[model samples]
Structures are given as structure tokens and as C-alpha cells.
Target: MDAYKLMTIAAIGFFVFALDKNQKKFPAPIILIAAGMFLAVFPYFSSMELTKEFIFHWILPALLFTSAYQFPQDQLKRKAAIIVTLGTVCIAITAVMLGFALYAAGQLLVGVSLAGAMLISSLLIPTDPVTVVSILTQGNDKHHLAETIEGESLLNDGTSVVIFSLFSGYYFGSQSLHIGTFILDFFYTALGGAIVGLLISWFVAKGIHKITFHVYQVWLTILLAYGSFYIGEALGVSGVIATVVSGLLLAKELTNKEEEEEKELRRDLKNFWGIMEPFLLSIVFVFIGIESIDFIQMDGLLFVIIGFLLSVIVRGIVLLATIKSVKPWRKSYTNGDITLVTWGGIKGTMSLALLLSITGQSGGSDDGLLSWAFMMIMLSLIVQSLTFYPLKEKLGD
Candidate 1:
């Protein structure tokens, strides 16, 4: 099957799924992912192999830019202290915990090597919950929890990417890892991407305000998003950060003006983003399923169990630590708030992207890793994402 044909089928399914309300029993991402895995398992279609070029060049840009464009600046700033602190420190702490947990778990039961365990741990660390959250939480009462979770996930995605790069470099022949280098890598990658994003967002917002033609203005935002990621990466920074920062900047820069001109602009922006979001999301899940076909054959059942347990333990430890930090704010955190944050860290497309990006001998030995990563991601999104509401209600009760 041709790539275009596969995409066409996915697009058609996505459209049909979107139209039916009763069939909306499951989120589109979940459906697309399930469809992808089915396609991979059966011969409904040929495997949709996701190449490095596809992930690095196209999908990453789409994912990041979309993230940048839709990010909520006010909410992010409102919880800025919590977001930054948890996003950065919490991710690092989780990564370390994941590494040790995997190592310890393997030692106790399965007995995998340190590098293999760490590799699996590193791949699952970046939480991608934007798509999951949008589908799960469709109301205002859960807004605060959603905001913090989304904000932290966005930031942690970057942090995890940076950590993965450091460990990968060490694993390969890039350079020996050191504290100074890690700090430098994180600083430049995240900060540089954000600065570039802000700069581009400022100009793009101004350009949008000036343009009478909505189409042109929308294209400008799209161009800026794709362009900023490459530019940030070229400058030795984190493309993930650049994309997010750009989104953050756009959120801050664009006001919800009801004037005719502003309203038109808002409508155009909304339509443009709206069209892109689901489509990108659909493609992401399809890609995951397509890629999973190649991976499912490579590993055994134990890998999946180890991967799933490692992910849960690491996530549990991270949330437990976060709760401890907010111990002082226990009165304000409310039992509900803490529980929501703990449960809302659902992983999705971002994990798939990173897993798909890995290649050659380093990842070759760990062929089962991607399959495990996908399984863990599905488990997190399904179990944690849905249960949070009940958990919230219980806490409130």
C-alpha cells in the first residue's frame, strides 16, 4: 500500500469517527492507535514504516508547532512556578528513579543489563498527554488539574528529550556525560528554543493582526512553527522547547478581542488550528500502529511486563515526590488536586515519536523497547486518564 493510500484511509476513518457521537465511546487517539496496531497485526495494509526523516523532519515539526500554537500562556504563567519547578526537577528525578527501578526490578526478577533497562526507562520518561487530556477532560471543574498536567507534560517532554540525548550520546560515541555538560545541554536547548519561539511568535502575532487575509496569516503561523524548530535545532538547542515556546508566545500575544477584525482573525486561527490538531493526532496514532507491526515480532512478553512495571513505578515515585514537595501546600493542594496531578500524567504521541526516532545497533538490540513503550503509553492513557475523574470525585467526597 502506498503511503498516501494509507493516509487517505486513516483520514477517512478519522472523519467517520468524528461524525458519529455514539461511536465516540472511545477517544480518537485510542481508536487510531488500536486501528494502527490492528493494521500492523493483520494484512489489511502494508506496514507504514516511519523513517527517521519522517519523524525528525515532518512529524516533530507538526507536533511541536501545534503544541506551540495551542498552548495556554495565562494558565502556564498562573502556575508558572509549579510548572517550571516540576517540569524540570521532577522529570530529572523521575528519570533517575526510572533507571534505578528498572535496574532493581530486573535484578530482582527478570535480570536485564543496566544499559538495556536504562534505555527502556529513558524512552518512557517523556509524558505526552495533550491529546489524551483533551479527550478525557471535557469540562471546567477539572480545568486546574488539566492545566497543570498539560503544562508540566509539555515542559517534561523537552526535559526528557534532553535527558535521552545525554544518555544516548553516552551510550554511543558522542561524548562522556558530565554534570556541567548536562546542565549546559538542558539550558541551551530549552532556553534557546524558547527565545527563538518568542521572537517568531511576537512577529507572527503582529503579522496576524495586520493581515486582512486570514489564509495568509494562518500560513504565517504554520511556517513560523515549522521553521522555528529547525532553526532551534540547528543552533544546538531543543526543538521541542522552541516549538512549545512559540506556542506559549502565540497564546500570550494573541488577545481574545471581539472586534470584527479581531474576531475574524480569531475565527481563522481557530479553524486553522482545529483542522490541524485532529489530523496530526490521527496521523500520529496511525504511525504508532504502523511502526508497532515491525516491533511486535522482535521481543517477548517479559519485555512488555518489565516496561509496563517500570513505567508505573517511575511515575508513582515521581508523583509521590511531587506530593512531598507540595506537602507544605497540603491545605491548598486538597486531596483532589494531588490525586488528579498524580493520575493525569498520561503518556501518548510524544513517547511514540521518540521511540520511532531511535535506530541502528543501539536501538537494534532493544527492538522490543518501542513495542513496550507503546504498550506502556496505552496503559497510562487508558488507565490513568480515565480514572482521574472518579478519583477526583472520590477525593471531593
Candidate 2:
């Protein structure tokens, strides 16, 4: 697609339709997906390909940094326990349960392997609430829930990526995964990434404090976002986790300096990143739809549907079990509220992004794992998002 044509379409689809309050119930990805699928029939729109390198190197870092910094530091501190458990423990357990479940169901699912099933399970661990956070923060009480919803994703995104990375190597025949080695490696990678991000971002913060020019300050943040990620990856640590940590620590540093100039700097940074994230994600989602036609196989829809069901059941069961340990979740939520949380955990961009990445690394795409993953994501987004409003209304705050 032509750049102008794509931008025009994204603007109309997003700003005009997606940003409308009435359409808040629907995710912007659905709109872009429809538009991309509609445009896919034409040859012009068919040529725009989304490469894994572009997404991981550019888009992922920016989104992680932007979201992390914007996340309130105080809320992160207040809800640390709940957030940590949900992100790490909840995701880990769900991934294990779902992975094993998928592997067991592989008799019906043609050519599916235990490794592929495990990768798919891990990839789906991250959730994207696009505009649902706005709906979640209707009042002061719900505001806490909103923060928790978004906050958990920030950390779990790293956990998800780490799990995917470990299993990806094993799936692709690049490296073998030993359980003992994997457990130790995961901790070292995650913890090392955090330390790297904190160290780099601390220096970046000092630089920001010294610099008076908002333009340079903004550019420095951009560097931090991408820099921390690339640097962490170079050191064989988790880049995703590094970027998240960099954003959080730097954001806390920036937020502490409440001077008028610093405030202006913050505004400028927000303005730049706020527009960039949606626009880039719009392009990525549209590309997902364009790419979808190739991956769609009618014969496998039943199996995919079965897989989706398994995913939901496993995630819900794991969440209900894991969340009881967190006092906030126990105190603030009933069974209905927990149902809403499970429903709201609709796999979105991160899931699809991770899914699409398979073709780039794995030779076979795990024998139609992409197709299975693509459909599973679509079902999750469409069913969960559309039903979310009804659930919200029924459950009440």
C-alpha cells in the first residue's frame, strides 16, 4: 500500500471510528483487521509486508517504553505484590497448563508438536487492553483495577517473551531446552535485563536533568527506549524486560522533577510517543489481516476453535487459582469480577506479533501453528472484546 493511502486509512479507521466513545467496546485492531482484509483483495495493498525484524527492533521497544513510563509509579509500588503474581506466576502456570493441554489435543490437531504448542501457549501470555483501560477507570475504585490490568501486562510481557524465547530455540532446533538449565537461565536473563535497564536509564535520567533543551530530552528518551533493548539483547539478556525497566525507572525519575520545564518536557515526550504507538500498532494489525488470508485453512477451524476453548479454560482456571493468593484480588473482586478479568484478558497485539514471528525463525511454522494461533487470537479478540461490555455491566464495580 502507498504510505499516504495507509496513513489516511489508519487515521480514518482509528481517529474517526476507533477513538469514538461509542466504539470503545470494540478494539482498534478489529477495525484495522477488517480494513486490511477488505483491502487484501487488491494487489496494491497485498505487497505491504510486516517483517519480524521491523516489529521486534522498532515497534516493540517504543511500545514497551511508552507504556512503562506512562504507568504511574505509585500504583506500581502499591500493587506490586498483586501485579508480580499475576504477571509472572499466573502467566507461567497458564502457559504450562495450556501447553500440556495443546500437546494432548495434538491427535486432532495435525502436525502439532509439544514444543509448538508450548510456544503458542507462552506467546499468548501478554494482553493488550488498547482502550479498555479507559472503560476500566470510570471511577476511583475501578481506577485501581485499571492500573492493575495494565501494570501486570508490562511485566508479564517480558515473562511471555522470555518463555517464548526459551521454547522457540527448542522448537526451531537451534538449541535444546533442559528444564534445569531453562529455569536458571530465565531468572538470570530477567534479572540481568532489569539491572541493565536500571543502570542505563539511571544515566539517561542524569543526562535529562542536565539537558535544558526539550528537543534533545525527547530524543534522548527515544534513544533510551531502543538503546536499553538492543543493549540488553547484546548482553544475552531479555531486551523486552530491559526496555520495560528503563521506561519505569526513567519515568519515576522524570516524574519526580516537577519543574515547569520538566513538565513541558514530559508533555512533549507524551505527545510524541502517544501518537506513535497507535499509528505503528495500526499498521501492524492491518498487516496481520493482510497476512491472514495465506494462513487461513477451513479444514483446521474446528481444531483451532478447540484450542481456543482450551486456552480460555486453562487461563481462567489458572487465574482463579493464582489470584486467590493476592490479597487485593481476593478483597476487591468476587467470582463475577474474576470472570470479567479472565474475559478481559483477550490476547491482542503481542500474541499476534509473537505468532507471526514463527515464520521468521522456525522452518515449518510448526505445521500450521500460525493458522491455529491467528484464528485463536481473532476469536479471543472478537469474542472477548464484544462480550466485555455486557460482562462489565453485569458484574458491576
Candidate 3:
């Protein structure tokens, strides 16, 4: 099928799913994903193809920006301690643990080179904000808890992307990284994206302040989000960070403006993103399911299972080490929250994007590994997305 036509069908399918008021009973993402898989199995859909550019340029920025903008900045500030610790420190711990585990496991089980396995491990570690945050925040009325989860998801994505890029560079790309250079390397990438996002957000807000029309102003933000991401990426900075920072900054600035015109624009933008959020999320998972149809193979099943186990073990260790500081980490949240959060770290689009970005040496070693990576990611998303809420309810005692 032609790409345009297939996308039209996807849009129709998503609309049907999105219109369901009982969306809480069934995740729109998982449903659309299942639809895509069903379509893929049909012989008539043999021509479908998933484009990497479509994901990076279109789907990712929209999803990230919407997630970031919808995040409650004030709530995030209120939970600053938990957010900062988990976002920065805990995320780094999880990444390192997972990378080393993959290195050791690959050598023992797959005979893969240590560096290559580490690269793949880095790619797999970052939890997709789209999947994880959506599940965690669905119906929970605890604003502080919700903010902590959302804020952690927002900031950790950038950290994970930066680390993933660094390892990818060291192992597969030309840029060499030594242990001593790790601090400087991380700072440059992350700080570069943050700075770019902040500046652009300020400029865009100022520009929109002059525009009294609400529709155009909202559209301007959409442009700015994509623009900041692409520009930051062009500078070899973290585009994900740039996109997210730009969103948070815009959300903060717009939330505070007292003027009637500004308030109206903010409302319009909020409503617009609210509609787009589920729509885009559904489309993303659909793309994943359709792509999986082409990539999933039986021979790689064992490796996929191993990768999933590695993901869980590393996350478990990180949570155990980091859960000490959360005020109500134990008391307010049950043993279930701790376990669910640890196991609920679902890898999705960001991981796939990292893998897709691999080219030449950065990618050569992972040729046979891509199928396994893709399968593990699909499994992560399905297992966690489906189980997170039920587990939360079952374990909330």
C-alpha cells in the first residue's frame, strides 16, 4: 500500500479508538498497536513500510512536546527532590547497570563484543515517556506522585539519549570516549540541548506575545518545538532535551501570563495538544506493530528474552539503591509501586530511534542484533503497558 493511503487508514483507525470514552479501560496505544499487527498479518498489507525519518522528524517531537507541555510545572517543583534524584542520579545508575549487564551477558551467552553489547544496552535502557508516564498517571489523583513520575520521565529521556549517543559514538562511531571525559561529554550534550531549548522558547514566547490571534500562536509553538529539536540535533546536541526543555519553558511562560489574549492562546494550545496527544500516541504504537511484522523472527527469540531479563534486573538494582530517599517511597507508595516502577520501565520509540540512528561502524556490529532489540522493545511495551495498571491495583494494598 502507498504510504499516504496507509497513513489515512491509520488515522481513521486511531480516530475510532480515540473517540472511545472508556479509554481508561483500554489504552489507545495498545489497541492501535494490536490493530496494526492485525493489519500486518493480512496479505494485502505486504507493501507497508516504516520510515525512520517519519518517526524522528514527525512523531517523536510531537509526542515529547505534548507530554512535556502537559506536565504540571508547579507540581514538578513541589516534588523537586524526588524528581531531581530519580531523573538525574537514578537514571544514570540504571543506564550504567544495564550497560554492564549486557556486556557481561553478551559475552557469556551470545559471544558478542563487550563494546557492542554495551551500545545496544544503552539503547535499550531509556524508558519511553509516552508509554511509562501515560500508564503511571492515568487515573492517579496524587498530584505530587504524578509530577514526580512525569518530571522524571521528561528529564531522564535526555540523559538516556545523551548517554546512548556517547556510547554509540565510542563503540560504533568515530569519536573516542575515555573514562575521564565522561563528565565533560555528558555536560556538553545535555547542556547544549537545554540552552538551545531555553533560548528558543523565550524567543518564541516573545514572538507569540505580539501575535494576538490564538490559532496562529498555538501553531507557532508547534513549529518552535520541531525547530528547536532539529536545530539542536544539527549542532550535535541532544534534540530530545531541547524539545522537552522548550516545551517546559513554554508551558511555564504561558501558564503565568495574565493578559486575556495570552490566556486565550494558552487555552487554545492546551486544547489542541490534548487532542493531538492520544492521536499521535496511537499512531506511534501502530507504527511499531506494523514494523514488527517485518522484523520479528523466531531465531532471535532467545536473545530477546535475555535482553528483557537484563532490562528488568538492571532496573531492579537501580530502584533498590535509589528508593531510599523518596519521602513516602515506602510508606505512601506500597511495595507494589516500587516493584511496578522498576518493572514498568518500558522501552519504546526513543530506543528504536537510537538504534535506527546507527550507521556504518556505529551500526555494523548490531546488524544481527536489531531484530532482537526490536522484539525486546515490543515485548517491553506490551508486557508493561498491559500489566502496569492492573499490577498497581492488585498491589496497592
Candidate 4:
């Protein structure tokens, strides 16, 4: 697409977002997605494809960085155990359980392969940090819950990607899982990404400290955010984790700056990103909406519905079990907390991106997988986003 057309689409998305904000009755993402779907049928947008590379490389990194940058470091530390366990361990468990369940159902109904089902399961395991954090932090006073959710969302992407890659290889008959090898690969990817991110951010921070120009500092910070991701990917590590780690490290450094000029630079950078967050999200959600039109008429809607229902059940059961096992340290959580967390596991851009990746590799022959993934995501966003706030209020009271 041409520059003018790209700008036009972005402008339309922003306009929808503005309208949604003004009404304050529904979430902006839902509105943007609906508008994208409405506009996608037109000739002008029919050719505008939402590619996996475009989303995974160009859009996701920035969104992940922005969300992680703003996350409260102290709160994250306080709830580290909960966040890590939910993000990594619970996600793994859910993926395995959901994978087998879907595989059995597919065999009995539509005959999807075990590997294909597992691949789909892995892709949908990670909750979208962008959507969850956006909803959880909006006019909600439950800081601990919000922080736990945000932190988990940020970290879970890496876990999901690692799992997805393993299953993808298995699907292609390129790789097989050995427990020790899998553990080693997971740590190497995740930890290596974190190390790369920290080192890059440290160097960038040092450079910023010496630079006097506020404009240059702001621009450099943006570069560093993307730079960290690219560097991690170049090293064959988890770029998503790298971006998150870099953003968090940089955010910590900027927040701790006592120098007046550095503080001014930090303020300018934050102001710039504040506008960027919504702009990027509008484009992403709209793209999801547009891409979803193709899958709407997919075969085996019943299979997708069954998978969606199973996902919720599995998530709830896992949360209940995990919460019971790992006692909270800072505060006690009630049944309502478990309910909110279970519902708040809303899937968004990341899930779609992973699905697109699989479809691209498999020549799009995996019957009903794409449709199932899309419907599950839509169900999560519509049901969870609408009810989370009210549920939180009721549970709190």
C-alpha cells in the first residue's frame, strides 16, 4: 500500500477510537475491530493483507515495549512468584491439556492431526498483554491484581513463543522434544534474550546520560527499543522477551535519574510514547478485525466453539489449582480474584500472529485451526473485556 493509503487507514482507526472514547460505553478495541471488519470488504482494503512478519516484527515489539515500560517495577518484584508461575508454568500446563483435548475432539469430529492441534493450542496459550493491561488498568483501583496480570502477560509471550516453536517443528517433522533439551532451549532463549536486552539498554542508557539534546535522547530511546528486539532475534533468541526486558531496564534507569536535564528528557520520551501506545493498538486491533473476515465462514464452527469452551474451563481449573498451591504473600485473594483472573485471560494480537505464522508454514491446510483460534480470541475479548470491570467491582464489594 502507498503512504497516503496507510495514513488513511490509520486515520480511520484513530477516528473510531476517538468515538469509542467519547461514548465510554464499550472498549475502544472492540469498536476499532468492528470498523476494520466493516471496511475490509471494500475493494481498497481487500488486498491489504495482515502478514505474520508485519505483526511479529514491526508492531508487536513496540506494543510490548510500551506496556512493559510503564509497568510498575516494585509491584512486579513483590508479585514475581505469582506472575512467573502463572505466565510460564500455568501456560505450559494449559497448552498441553488444551492440545490433547482439541486433538481428541478433532479426531472424533473433523480429524485434525495431534501435532496440528498441539500447535494451535500452543499459539493460543499466551494471553495478550496489550489487551489485558489496557482493560485492567482502566479506572481500576486493584493495583496488585492489575500488576500481577500485566506482569504475567508481559512474560508469557516468551513462554508461548518457545512452546509454539517446539510444536511447529514437531508439526513439520523437523524436531522432536526431549525434556532436557526442551528445558535447556527454553532457558537459553529466554535468559539469553533478557541478558541481551539488559546489556543493550544499559549501553543506551549510558549514551543518553551523556547526550544533552532532549530530542536526540527521545529518538535514541525509540531506536534502542527496536534495536534490542532486532539484536535478540539476530542472536536466535526470544525478541519479545528482549524487548520487554530492555523496556523495563530502561524505564527503571530513567525513573531513577536525579539530574534535571535527564529528568526532562525522560518526561519528553514518556509523553511521546503515551500517544504512541493507542495509535499502535488501534492499527493492530483493526488489522485483526480485517483478517478475521476470511475465517468467519470457516468450516467446523462447532469445533471452534468446543475449543473455546474448553479453554475457559481449563483456565479456570488451572487458576484454582495454582492459587491453592502457591499461597499469596502480600495479600489474600478471594474467590472473586480467581474468577477475575480466569476471565481476564483475554487473547489478542499475539495469538493471531502465532496462528498466521502456522498457517503460512502449513500452506493453510489445517482445517478449522485458524477459525478456532480467531473465534476463541474474539470470544475472550468480547466477553472478558466487557465483564472484567463489573466483575472486579462486584468481587471487591
Whichever of 3 and 4 has more TM-score, that candidate is 4
lDDT: worst 10-residue window of model 4? 17-26
lDDT string for model 2 (201-250, tens) is 99999998888888899999999999999999999998989999999998
How well is each residue in 1-397 modelled by candidate 3, as lDDT tens digits?
Answer: 3767467556755685658544444656677778778777776664666566777888788878988888887776776777777777777777777777776777776776666776777777777655445555655543344466667777887887777767777776567767556677678888999999999999998898888777888889889889999999999888888999999889898888888877777778889998877766666677677777766888757767887888888887777667755566655655556676676677877787776666334335456677777787888878777776677667662
**How accurate locally is residue 373 in candidate 2, as Cα lDDT from 0 to 100?**
78
Ranked by lDDT from best down, the candidates are: 2, 4, 3, 1
> Over all chains combined, what TM-score does candidate 2 have?
0.93
Give the Å error, residue 55, model 1: 3.0
Misplaced by over 4 Å in model 1 are 1-4, 16-25, 41-44, 108-110, 256-258, 297-300, 327-329, 368-371, 381-397
Candidates arranged by TM-score, highest first: 4, 2, 3, 1
The candidate, 2 or 4, that scores higher on TM-score is 4
TM-score per candidate, chains pooled:
0.88, 0.93, 0.90, 0.94
Task: Give the alpha-carbon lDDT of every model.
Answer: 0.68, 0.80, 0.74, 0.79
Q: Indicate the worst ten consecutive residues by lDDT in candidate 2.
A: 16-25
Q: Which is superior by lDDT, 3 or 4?
A: 4
- Best by TM-score, which number? 4
lDDT of 2 at 198: 93
Error of 3 at 173 (Å): 5.8
